[model samples]
Structure formats: C-alpha cells, structure tokens
Target: MVLIVLGFIIFIAINVVVKNNPVAAKFAGAGRILALVFILLGISTACVKQIDAGEIGVKSLFGSIQNDIMGSGLHFINPLLDVKKLDVKTQNYTMSGVNDEGNKAGDDAIKVLTSDGLEVTIDLTVLYRVVGADAPRLLRETGEDYRDKIVRPITRTKIRDNAVYYQAVDLFGSKRDEFQQRIYKSIEDDF
Candidate 1:
C-alpha cells in the first residue's frame, strides 16, 4: 500500500515537472516507472504463499475449486481466492486393554462365535495409518467422518466376510492365519 502511494506521488511529480523542465521530467518518469513496477511486484508477491514440505493445499478461485493441488514450496496465488493447506503426514496410534485371563492385553481384540448364529464381542486394538495418497478425495467425500464410515465399516465387513467362510473352530485354530489374511485382503479392497 505504501508503495502504491509512493508510485502515485512519483507519477504526479513527474507530470508536474514535465510542464517546465523536460529533461528533469524524463528522469522523474523513470522514477515513476520504477515505483509503479515496485508496487505491482509487491502486490503480486504479497499474494503468493509458501507451503511447507509434507503439506498440501486446496486452491479455489471465486468459490470454484481448482483441480490442481499445491504442494511444498513457494507459489503465486490470487488474492481473491488462494490456498488452504492441509497437512499430510504419517501418524501413530496406540491402544491397550485388560483380558479375563488376568493379563494386560497387547492391544489386541478377540471376537468369537458359537455353533448357533450370534454376534460375539471381541476385544481388539488396531494400530493403523494411511499408506495411500487419496486423502483429499477421502476428506472431501467423507469430511471428518471418514474414519467411522469408511474405515470402521470396511473393518467390520472384512471381519464378517472372513468369519462367515469358516466354522468357529477355524477362528481359534490352525486356520486362523488364513482367516486373518483373508480379512486383510478384504479390508484392503475396501480401503
């Protein structure tokens, strides 16, 4: 803003001087040009943003979302509609529980079933992280509820789908590994 004011002053001074001294006015004109250039460059620079590493930004122009994603480093943006950043980084989760066995559980849960059809409660802990790059779409589509809707449903589906394929014996015996792998595959597909 100051630069804009200075540029206007220089331009007026140049025009005034031009009325009497032509040579001095020519030098003043140069100053005016430089000042105006400075003002424009300053405005443009002010509109730019510098996103840090591991950050992603969604840019919108006049309420229209831009398809291109902005990432780490400096970028020039329009003052009218600019960047909104979202951090994308690996995170950690921890869970613990106590079992009837009188032992501290190592973040694991167990769901059981009987010969008759019934829902069994299982104690389990999951330490998971996002290992993909579809976070923007994920967030946009599900907002903050992505975990509950996408993650938990997929997890439950995986468990149900795999569990149905085997009898109760398989869940606790040698077939457990196969059941777990199947569950993992199912979850992966959903994810």
Candidate 2:
C-alpha cells in the first residue's frame, strides 16, 4: 500500500513539477517509469500469497471474513485482502503441575472435585489439530488465538465436568481408563 501511494506521489510530482522546470524536464519520462515500477511491484507483492506445507490461510476483506480458504501453495488474491496463516498439523497442549512443562508458566494443572468430595490435580496432555475446511469459520468466530479463548477453557471444563462421575481414588487407579475415555468423548463432541 505504501509503495503504491509513494508511486502515485512521484508520478504526480513528475507530471506537475517537471513540466514547469525546463532543467529537470529531461527526467520526466524517467520519473514516470520509476513510479510505474513501484506500482507494479506493490501490486505483485499484495496479490500473491504463499502458504507453506501443513498450513492453511484464512482471508478477510475490509473486516469481513471470507469462507473460501487458501491451501498450501501460491495463490493470487485481491490486494486488499488480509491473509492469516494457520498450521493444520497435529498440535499438542499440556497442563501440568511442573513449571515449564505446560503451555503457560507455573502449575497449570486442572483441579477437579470427585463424587467422593476429594480434590484431584490432573496433568493433562491434549493432541489436536485444525480442520482445514473449517479454518475460515474458526478464525471468524474465535479469531487467531483459539487456544486461549476456546481450547484451554473448554478442555478443562469438560475434564472437571466428567471427573465428578468417579471417585478421586478411582480416577487415579482402577477406573482411570474409563475416566479418560469419558473426558475424551466429552471433549471430542464439544470440539
């Protein structure tokens, strides 16, 4: 955009200013050429988008999100459109009791109350990925930082919601797999 603006300024100056100055009049054509170069360069840069492997692009124009997406490759698009690249590969998120082991600082483990009225600390690791076809809707509704706005909160809530179905000791021992499976189903449905 700046380049295009600068190019227009130079073009106007050459036509209006150079015509009056006989000494610099010889360079009028050269100035117009330079301006054209800048404009073309600006247009090319803005129209071409390159998406890397395992990534998708969501486009928005004038603050309105577009439904159609851009796959991994070069795409020619509107110069005014804004493109946000998102990774589509499997992503890992952890909420652990140990510092520096989770996505956030400090102990980010989930605390859930069991049916027996016991408080349990859970270190959770979730593996997930963005659906390429749903990237546009995801961006439109949740913006780019969906992990903080959607994933983390929803995951913790589902875990806590299902934890009450079992006793605290069972969650860590005999019924651990059942507890995990229940939460997994809950989270999957929500997502």
Candidate 3:
C-alpha cells in the first residue's frame, strides 16, 4: 500500500508540479516509469504466497477462516488474506519410562490400574499428522498448540480407559495387541 501511494505521489509531482520546469521536464518520463514499477511491485508481493514442502496453508480473510487449504507451492490469493502454514508430514509424540526419553524431563510413561488391581507402566509413542482439507478447521478450533492441548491429554486418557479391561500380565503379553487396538479405535473416533 505504501508503495502504491508513493508511486502515485511521484507521478503527480513529476507531471503536475514540475511540468513548467524545462530542466525537470526531461526527466519526467523516467520518474513516471519508476512510479509504475513501485505500484506493480507492491501488488505482486501482496498477492503471491509460497507454501513449503510437507506443509499446508490455512487462509483466513478478515479474521474469518476459509474452508479451503493450499498445498505446497506458490499460490495467487487475495491481498487481504492471512495464511498460516502447518506441517502435514508424520509427527511423533512419545511417553517413556526413562527420563529425557519423552517430551518432558521426568518419567512420562502412562500408569494405569488393571482389572486385577495391578499397576502397569507403559511406554507409548503416537504417530499422527494433519490432513490438508481440515487444516482450516483444525487451526480455528485447536490453534497451533494442538500437540499439548489436544493430542497428549486425549491419548493418555484413552489408554487408561482401555487398560482397565485387561489384567497387567495380559496388557504386557497376551492381550497387548487387543489393548492397543481398542485404544487406537477410541482415539481415532474422537480425533
């Protein structure tokens, strides 16, 4: 906007203010060309957006989220729109028994009470990603901190909920697959 305004000011000063000066009249054409260049440069920069690989763009216009998303590439869009880039590549979150292994400094593994009243400590790693088509809604509803606010709490809760259905020994050996499948199904539905 500043560029466009400055361009117009230059054009007016060259053509109107200096029209009567014989010495300035010789350079008026060059000043006019420079003014047009500034106007074009501002418009081009404002309308073009580039999204990096493994990322998607969520566009919002005048603070309202748009339903559509932009994939990795250059896009021509409205000058007034704001774009937030989100990575679509696979992401991993871990809860581990060892300190420094999980996202937190302490032992972050899940502890749950089994049906037989035994305490079970489980180390879990969850892999997830954002879908391009839902990026706008996800951004609007969850914001950028979806990892802590949404993913972590929900995963821990669902695992604990499913753990009580099996004995501690079964969760570690025989019914381990079943327990994992049940937890996955519940979390998938909620997500």
Task: Report each candidate's C-alpha RMSD, comma-separated, in the order given.
Answer: 9.4, 1.9, 4.3
Among these predictions, the greatest lDDT belongs to 2
User: How well is each residue in 123-143 modelled by candidate 1, as lDDT tens digits?
Assistant: 433334543355456555665
Tell how far residue 39 is off in model 3, in angstroms: 6.5
Error of 3 at 177 (Å): 1.2
> Candidate 2 local accuracy as lDDT?
0.93
* lDDT measured at residue 114 in model 1 versus the true structure, 0 to 100: 36
User: Against the hidden true structure, what lDDT does model 3 obtain?
Assistant: 0.90
Count clashing pairs, candidate 1: 5
Candidate 3 per-residue C-alpha lDDT over 57-161 given as tens digits, one digit per residue, 9 for 90 to 100:
999988889999998999999888889999999998999999989987799999999999999899999888988888888988989899998889999999999
Residue 182's lDDT in candidate 2: 92
Please give the range of 10 consecutive residues that has the lowest summed lDDT in model 2.
15-24
Model 3: how large is the Cα RMSD against the reference?
Answer: 4.3
- lDDT: which is higher, 1 or 2? 2
